[model samples]
Target: MRKWFIERAPDRDVLLKSRWLAPVASRLAPATIWQFNRRSIARGLALGLFVGFILPIGQIILAVLFAASIRANILIASAATLITNPLTFPPIYYAAYRTGTFLLDLVGGARAAQTIAAAQPTGIWTSLSATSLSTFVGLLVFATLSSILAFAAVHLAWRVSLIWRWRRRGGTDRAVTRPTIHQEPPSV
Candidate 1:
């Protein structure tokens, strides 16, 4: 499954040579960031998830930098940030805003709730009014939770895959190695 997925993913060389990334090719060590491993992949995923939610633009650039700094897989980090792409961004941000508003209201009482309700945000880039504050706080919370969950999920999936492969091969190996009694055919 992993091999299949990797095969279908964008090639490291192709991405590096692309016009948009060619200028920064010197800074990107494809080998270091492209290799697949448990630690690197998990860290990359976490970094991607966190950055994806926090920054709507330049997510790939930020992910690559973060992955390189943390010795994680840059490709994975860049790809993982797609979680907040156009198709899913609205819902995620809305949920984050709602969550932030709820928490603020819970902690700050009706006055805070009323304040947040009064400010109608035209978009994500609006001023830091009550509504925006709650939205920001909620985004932070959601990013944190998503990062942690993504890391854990990757680790869990890796472990499970390893165990499954081991069990499968173990059974086959035993079957192949087990002695099979043979008797000469009765003399005819």
Candidate 2:
């Protein structure tokens, strides 16, 4: 699984050459940022999911920056932001707005929100203050929960994969190598 991805990912130089990535090329030089380890990939996925869920714009750019700062897998971070692409955007935003409305209503802010929305007409891309705020709150909640869930899922999957591979090779006992202690000296 790992090898398949490593084979398909763009080279460091290739990414550096792209105009969009050129400005931050200096920060991308660290080998650790591109590593395929469980921790890095998990962090990358979490970051991507968080940004993707929270922000309507600049998801990839933001994910890249976050991934670089956290030393996550950049490719994974970039790819994970696809969770909020065109096909999925409507449902996600609609759900987020509804969730925010419910939470606000539960906390006694629904009247104020409804009054504000009713007072003004909102465009497709832009909305009144109250509506936007509700959506933002909902997005924040979604982003936090989803990121946490994604991180845990990645780690769990990786653990399962490792156990499966070990079992396939032989058994759990064979997967571990205990350190050997020198009990006696051997004569040559």
Candidate 3:
């Protein structure tokens, strides 16, 4: 899985040559931000998840900025931010709106809930209205929780993989190093 991910991920050269990223190339310290360590990868995933959930536009840039600020893996951050792509956007946003509305109704009362329900968000532009405070709150909650989960998951996976490899190697080494009978000469 790790090898597959590494093979499929965009290398530094590809990212550097990207026309969309050229403007910010100077600002990004590629080596520092692209290193693949537990902390960097976990943080990058978290940042990417957070930005991906909150903003529809400029997600890549936001992920890059967040990754750069925290010295996380830039490639992973950029890739992970694709969580909110076209196919997944509507459902995620709708769920967020519903979650927000529910929370607001619970906290504020029926009036606030009615207001959010009354404002029909036909498009992305209309969705950002101040009238729909529930949507914003819901997004914030979703983003925060998603980021935290992503970070923990990455960290846990890394640790589990390391342990699995270590245990497998220990068993394999014992079997390989075991003494064998010297009966080849008799057979010949």
Candidate 4:
């Protein structure tokens, strides 16, 4: 096995020297961004699109984190979030509400039952119209929970895929191997 750490030029030495701050600097500092692997970028884009369509917030963050961990360009990952931009907010929110309602029924059936009964007189049409407090709260709760779930799914997906890829590439000699932290190079 061979590992090499390229020494940064003197003008950019401070950024390259601070072990703790180097990673952050790499992310936030401006530089001539480069693409690592086209295949990985394509896979990431597809994943980001699916996530944005189904799970916006969590998907956005997960995509960013995933790219960051792999030392991919953060700008591209950040752009992927546009998949769920303002244009699609309403529909996404609506779907999130329905999903949340389903989850609420499963986990807190009794509470949901009570809320439904108490808010029944508001009428089904009126309830989902965003006028009633219960409806609003339900929607909010559903979006939050769904977002959480989506994030969990993203995390699991990244871990599983990364592990599988590593093993397939013949990197599984150890039963357990900690993931590496990918950092960008300091700009000259």
What does candidate 4's lDDT look like per residue over 65-99, in tens digits?
Answer: 55556554444455555656788777756665665
For model 2, residues 1-188, the per-residue Cα lDDT tens digits are 67998999989887888898778888887888899999999999999999899888999998998899999999999999999999999898888888888889889786776676667776553355667777787888999999999999999999999888877877546547533475455569
- Total residue pair clashes for candidate 3: 0
Q: What is every candidate's alpha-carbon RMSD to the true fold?
A: 5.8, 5.8, 6.7, 15.8
Query: How well does candidate 3 score on lDDT at residue 97?
Result: 81
Runs of candidate 4 with Cα error greater than 4 angstroms are: 1-24, 28-33, 36-39, 46-66, 108-188
> Model 2, which residues run further than 4 Å from truth?
115-127, 172-188
- Assess candidate 1 and give its lDDT: 0.82
Error of 1 at 123 (Å): 14
Across 1-188, the per-residue lDDT of candidate 1 in tens digits comes to 56876888788777778888777776675576777889889999999989988888999898998888888998789988899888998898889888987887788853555655557645444434656677788989988999999899999999999999899989999988776778455588
Q: What lDDT would each prediction earn against the true structure? A: 0.82, 0.86, 0.81, 0.52
Q: How high is each candidate's TM-score?
A: 0.78, 0.81, 0.77, 0.36
Which 10-residue span in candidate 4 carries the lowest summed lDDT?
1-10
In candidate 1, list every pair of residues with a backbone clash. Answer: none
Model 3 has an lDDT value of 0.81
Span of ten consecutive residues with least summed lDDT in model 1: 121-130
